[model samples]
Target: MTQPPPPPPNQPPGPPPGDPQGGFGAPQDPPPGGFGAPTPPPQQPYGYPQQQPGQPQYGYPQQQPPTQPQYGYPQQPPTQPQYGYPQQQPPGQPPYGYPTQPQYAQTPPPSGGKKLSAQAQIIIAAVVAVALIVGGGIWYASSGGGEEKNDTAGATSGASQGKGGGNGVGGNGKEKAPANPQAKLAFQLPQPKVQDITDVSGSWLTDKAYVKTGVDSIVGYDLDKGAAAWTLALPGQVCGASRHVTADNKTAVLFEATKRVGPRFYQPCTEVGVIDLTAGKLVWSKSVTGGSAGDTKARFSEVTLSGTTVAAGGTDGGAAFDVANGNPRWSPKPNAQDCYDMGYGGGAGLVAARKCGPYDSQYVVIQNLNPLTGAPVSQFKMPPGVKYASIVSTKPLVVAADVGDTAGDGSGISDFFSIDEKTGKLKAKITADADRYAARCRSTEVESCTKVLVGNGRIYVPTEEHEGSSGEYGDETNEIVSFDLATGKPMTGKADAGDKYTLVPLRMDGGNLIAYKIPPYDKGGQVVSIDGGTMQATTLMENPSDDSVRDAENSFGTDYAEILYGNGRMFISDTMLSKPRASSSTKEYLALAFTTH
Candidate 1:
């Protein structure tokens, strides 16, 4: 009380007291949004005791719910900047409310009793000990603030860690599933047990695919390294064929030539598993069956060729087998049903689409046959439900899709006809938008007809809307159109559509058009690719419907175009023991190759 001058040990924080001109501390620029607005409750501190009508007072909870004028001095803002931005104000307060920083120039306390100056009373005891350490560091940071969902559930339940203004951290909770660019995404399928492993001659460049695994096995998915490099063990029984899909060198692994169908079973036919991506092995397998599997009127799916001579077509129809030894090398009198109908053909020879009603429905034949015996030598056509063929400008053309009937019940008017594989006739009949991508008839064969998609030269039908043409809204809308490759026609001139997308479980690629979405809990699938000369589509990946979306029709894409994509991976097959049976030339199938990236 009589000797007070012991203050100089460190002295850094100093600024308070009614000093006529001496406080200047830096951080004073606050008042603009600091302690602003809701601060009219101050003068009651002298005696501070007035709470009767509302008994529970100071501990606060009597009806204090209208908050949101916050900023008891900081800590607020955990992620609000979305709507056009600009609305954050709360330090010394006053952004849209005025005021501005470190202000307080209100000095006036030295009139009559003007006191000390040994440094002006040692600067009022260092400004009253720096306003008690700045009001005890603003009451220890507004007592660890509250309310914004218990400080965001205590910073995401990690028990408080992310400090600095607005905690609520991120990542470490494990969220991995976002990237899926896709170049072609393994053909988007899950419904194709075994549609030809190649041997009778669809000869897609050798591996031919399947080596055994109808119920499950003999897999192959390399889309640029996402995994499952190879799985060909054998013996379960479906089929294979992967000769030139792309992304690189292309590989095949076929097997199904055990003909005899009975007497201990054997006409499922086809077996040539070659791998050689650089010498992988299992390169030679040929069993093909004498008549090659054509007697009793015929039944082969496809295996075309003309140079090394392997031409097979079925329903007891197409033939020319001798890729060095499968032997028969000549057939068609059995009426190879016009070559190849429903799907798959272009291995170098067969075009197939023999519906033949309008005087041989545009004829579209393409059969130089005689690879050494298949013998037709010449039979070309192109405008009858064109054979679902692929191979741009290189010349091979055939397409066919129909649905016309004026409704006598044959699902009214729908069409597709492109021919001319070498003169059997009709070169180009691809109707503009072919009346809505047409398909819903009642009679027409190539396996009864309902799908057709050739490549870059253009052709991708799947439509239905003229059964009674319009009105009260209900054409059922199921389109997907395209055409126009060096003149087969229909790229839009009038069924005229672009970027419409929706084929239920549609498929077709030599560029891209995959489909299938919505079934049970969503097997997480959806693809897209449309660059057959910049038609440009591009959706490529959607995956994640779980457990491979119930095998989404065996996961399509032997060549839906852009070639191959990675991860968010795909492959699906179980076609009931390798489906492609004309009475069983060797059938047994199953395929799998999933992964969500």
Candidate 2:
């Protein structure tokens, strides 16, 4: 009954001897002098029971039921490395197998005893091997094995938390979207009453953005801080919303009101609402009629702004409002039977209107009206058969063409001219090969056409290529021909081109043309910095895949893709509203911004 030495601190007491369960602790390594193969079992002492049939016959002891069955030791094999057991044994080690041997104590061979036969030695050796296996399993289960499994369980729980917590990389990687480095969540959109084909409609100023949530509400989000700056909710249901942002990004007009009519009819909202974006308040909401109700032709109803003048016209004619005070500057007689296209002539310091009497007719009246007084600065009749015309530039020049004319359309070949801003008289006419002049610009009088860029005293137009020619992909054309803005003659010098990439001039950025290179379908696109003074082109940054932009469009119901430049920053987003089916898991909207300065 002498006591054994106690274990070191933090170690559990070993199981009692003859306690049925084997002792629990680190298993002793094999003696340095390896145990020679077993010789034979020692003879039983007098009165010891004879070995029973079908029972263990080797010198091994009888099997003992596990003291703690809850440990489940020996019930299942440990597949992973446990305790100090190597994950995989070195070559020639005993292969892991069933615990065939029984536990037994080591006793020195009986001195001078008869050496056992070969068969007896084999049985004895096998028993010793099984004993080691069973002994190792029992020790692992009792001491810290339960805790190890628990640690594993805890790790699993942690992984689940990371997936659902809405933190960084919140969901399954393959199924989740990567965060956009260029933009952040400015704000969550309010619960939409109706999830229409359109997503959140928005427009951007320098540091702020105007987003139309639902039908009647406009929320201004601060782009720099990624938070809402202000929100204005108009009375009555609103639809067919369109936005016009000021050059300064401080003011905007949301032409979203009046229940929509048929596609061609526009019922202008009772009043147009002009928002002072920086102030986050409505600058003025005044009575107006003939605003668009989703009519493509009735776009005349949409609000238009130029310089400091903000104007909205409809079948009810047109009116100008002071952007500074929102006071009425001038308006035509109400219910006039004409459609007028209003826009800012930034270069001329004026606002002009082109009124078509019968809609898309061959000829229309053009007037360079004083934005402040609403009086004509000059008036002239468009050249006969001029099906499409826009006041693209205000430096006393007029450019007109069908944009794209093929032999079959019978829309006469595209022609351009320069006219006097003061006299509204034709000044000069110049021509380029219709097939080679690939400025297939949009016919809308409001939106700027990519094929024609007016800036830096030169008009940059797309030159064409014959079908199957190398430049057939005009978008991939690097060199663009420029024309003198004043003389209607081709300007000298070839516009610098990108390598195997066509450069399209979007707008004038300082003395450089802020433009983008049209990437091949699905490849991706990039913004280009064109030095207009030298026609030198330098790419700015590669844009995200067209798919990402398309995803934004699908979620937002945007009608067109656009790149907006302001405050030394580039804001690229979808414009207009048209619902396109999208994946349900897509983010609600996407706005990408890049530093341009």
- lDDT of all predictions: 0.30, 0.40
Q: After superposition, how far is residue 304 of candidate 1 from its true place, in Å?
A: 4.5
- Provide the global lDDT of candidate 1 against the true structure: 0.30
Q: Residue-wise lDDT of candidate 2 within 480-548, one digit each (tens)?
A: 656554545444345544444555555554344555555555544555555544555555555455575
Off by over 4 Å in 1: 1-349, 352-365, 368-374, 381-397, 400-428, 432-460, 463-501, 504-515, 518-523, 526-597
lDDT of 1 by residue, 367-460 (tens): 3222332223223332223422332111344433332222232422233334444332333433322323333321332222223444434555
lDDT of 2 at 476: 47
The lowest-lDDT stretch of 10 consecutive residues in candidate 2 is 146-155
Residue 454 displacement in candidate 1 (angstroms): 11
Give the per-residue Cα lDDT of candidate 2 at 459.
61
